[model samples]
Target chain A: NAGVTQTPKFRILKIGQSMTLQCTQDMNHNYMYWYRQDPGMGLKLIYYSVGAGITDKGEVPNGYNVSRSTTEDFPLRLELAAPSQTSVYFCASSYLDSSYEQYFGPGTRLTVT
Target chain B: GIQVEQSPPDLILQEGANSTLRCNFSDSVNNLQWFHQNPWGQLINLFYIPSGTKQNGRLSATTVATERYSLLYISSSQTTDSGVYFCAVVSSGGSNYKLTFGKGTLLTVNP
Candidate 1:
């Protein structure tokens, strides 16, 4: 069902480089999220959107930006990639029902040198 | 910021063994979920239990909001169950959909 899809499975960027991580969900869920997983660390929220045209920052939103212009797409933008931003990024979507279960993408592994 | 703690950072179990993973949060949450991230980095949802118990096949979960703790039980564990188990909670306020995750429990199953 291609529940959630993230583009650029892998990327290596030099410091100051910029790139966008694309995420799309076919479930038409209202909630979408961006998280980064460091080595041996759990997922940390970078940003999240409750619905289209509404977005907010999360715990570790310092090096990233996000926009939710449509229900099917929520993209994370890295304006000036830094070494600290190197990590595996995961995109997820949820229906916000009683279960509150989130479906995640395969993930994007990024390394900033 | 809400704190999440997962017990037994590392676990080793033989095939067919049973195990329980624990997660304790610093505050009450509107959402709590368990996920299994395999070696390949694919995250699979195991449960979305804010409270009460729910089971799916050989896996089950229980979240006690009042006690600020949750337990995930894995029965008859197989090699496929070897991965990182994560517990995440979404606190009240505008961050309801944003999850705060624990360090995770890494399970290694020996067949």
Candidate 2:
């Protein structure tokens, strides 16, 4: 299986610009998540989906939105990019079971200028 | 919100040396995992151990759920093992799908 995959390995956005980060998983996982990691810091959850049509805000969801239209896809939308939003973004997926061992994607590095 | 803390934020070890990384959580957790982020920026899941002990090759992990702490052991470390190690957990009382991550322990193994 392809596990989890993300698009646009790197991106540079201007202030107020908007973009969507794509994430897909072929593991048939019922749970998907978006997280951002700053340099030298741990990752912070941005958004997550329990299943198709079920999405929820995570720890740092202020500047982001997400949608789970299909079990295979969960996309994160940035309405207005800012310098603070510049970070390495990661997408992960896991089975919806007692053991939520998540598998992560390669990550997208974004820089807001 | 649950708090997760990892110790020895930085470590430098010689090749073939052994090292241990620790993760401590502020609350009870239903899920705990260790991930190794290589220099190339790929997060590889090392262990999905919420409790008890598990080992794979030169790496091993032990979690004491009751104590809310976990340990990751790397024996005979190699330069390839140089990277950031992260520990994440899901609070038993919080959303099962959300994981709180620790700052991570950065290990540098020199040949």
Candidate 3:
């Protein structure tokens, strides 16, 4: 199974523009997360979903939003992109009972100018 | 909030040498895992070792929960092992699903 898949492997956005980073998992995982990593730094969680329709904020969720309408999909929206949002984003999923052993997809490299 | 720290920041090892990387967490955690980020930037899961010890080929990991730290041991290292190693943890209870990653240890093995 393609454990997890993310769309638009790379993207560049202008200031005030918007875009969506899509993530999907065929494993039917009950948990999904969005994280961003700056150059030479650790990842910072932007948002997470326990199940479809249940979402929560994480450490750095200011410029991003997420929606989980189905068990197989979680999409992150950048409403008004800024240069500060430039980074690499990763999508991950895991089973409910796994206690957070996640499967990460190939990351999306995003640049906001 | 929990803090995760990994060391020695940077390491350069000769081929066939052995090395150990460390991770220290500031609070109790429900889950822990190790990941290797290769040159191309893909994160590969190495081990899901919250406690105890586990071995996989030339690599091994030991997490001493009581001490709030974990160690990853690599034996007979090769050039292919050159990459960044990260330690991520999830806090106990409902927040256990969110992982906080360390800055990572950069390992370079020269032939």
Candidate 4:
């Protein structure tokens, strides 16, 4: 079903470099989310959107930005990336409200030096 | 901010064994979910169970929202089940639709 897909499976960036992580869902989900999982830590939400043009900040929204111009896409951008930003990033989508199950993408591993 | 806590931060089980993972939250929630992150860092949805009990293959989950706690059972453990299991919750109010996650329970099933 191609529930959710993310691009740039692995990436390495130098400090101050900016890059964008792409995410798409074919499930026609109305909700999209971005999360980062640090080693030995649980996932933390960076940003989310309830639908196109509707976005909000999550637990950890610093150093990142997101845009949801279409239902199938929710991309996260890192500006002036820092080494602390290095982590495994995941994108997810859900069909119903937050009460329902969320489908997650494979994840993108980013390393900033 | 709501808080979620998972038990037995780390566990090592033998293949064919049985184990139970628990998740506790600080308040009432409208929904709850469980996921297993594989060794390759892939997040796999295990159960969408917000309440009651549901079983799939050798895995089952039960959530008593009233008690603000949930339990996941893995029977006949397998090496494939070796990974991190996370539990998340969405509180009752719509003020926040974000899922608050627990630290997770790391399970290593030896074959």
lDDT of 4 by residue, A17-108 (tens): 99999999999999899999999988898999989999999989999999999999999999999999999999988876545567899999
Candidate 2's residue-wise lDDT over B1-111, tens digit each?
A: 889999989999999999999999999888899999999888999999999999999999999999899999999999999999999998988964788999999999999
Question: Per-residue alpha-carbon lDDT of model 4 for B1-111, expressed as tens digits?
Answer: 789999989999999999999999998887799999899889888888878999999999999988889999999999999999999987776464777889999999998
Docking class of 1: medium
Q: lDDT for every model?
A: 0.92, 0.94, 0.94, 0.91
Q: Model 1 off-target regions past 4 Å?
A: A96-99, B93-96
Best by TM-score: 2
- Per model, the share of native interface contacts recovered reads 0.75, 0.78, 0.69, 0.67
- The TM-score obtained for chain B of candidate 1 when compared with the true chain B: 0.97
| Model 1 / residue B40 / CA error / Å | 0.6
Q: What local lDDT score does residue B54 receive in model 4, on the 0 to 100 scale?
A: 97
Residue A22's lDDT in candidate 1: 100
* Residue pairs clashing, model 2: none
**CAPRI-style class, candidate 3:** medium
Runs of candidate 2 with Cα error greater than 4 angstroms are none
Candidate 1 per-residue lDDT, tens place, B68-94, comes to 999999999999999999999887643
For model 3, the superposed segments whose C-alpha errors exceed 4 Å read B93-96
TM-scores, one per candidate: 0.94, 0.98, 0.97, 0.97
DockQ of each: 0.69, 0.79, 0.72, 0.69
How well is each residue in A31-80 modelled by candidate 3, as lDDT tens digits? 99999999999888899999999999988999899999999999999999
lDDT per residue, candidate 1, A12-96, as tens digits? 9999999999999999899999999999999988899989999988878997889999999999999999999999999999996
In angstroms, the error of model 1 at B107 is: 0.4
The ten-residue window of minimal lDDT in model 2 chain A covers A94-103
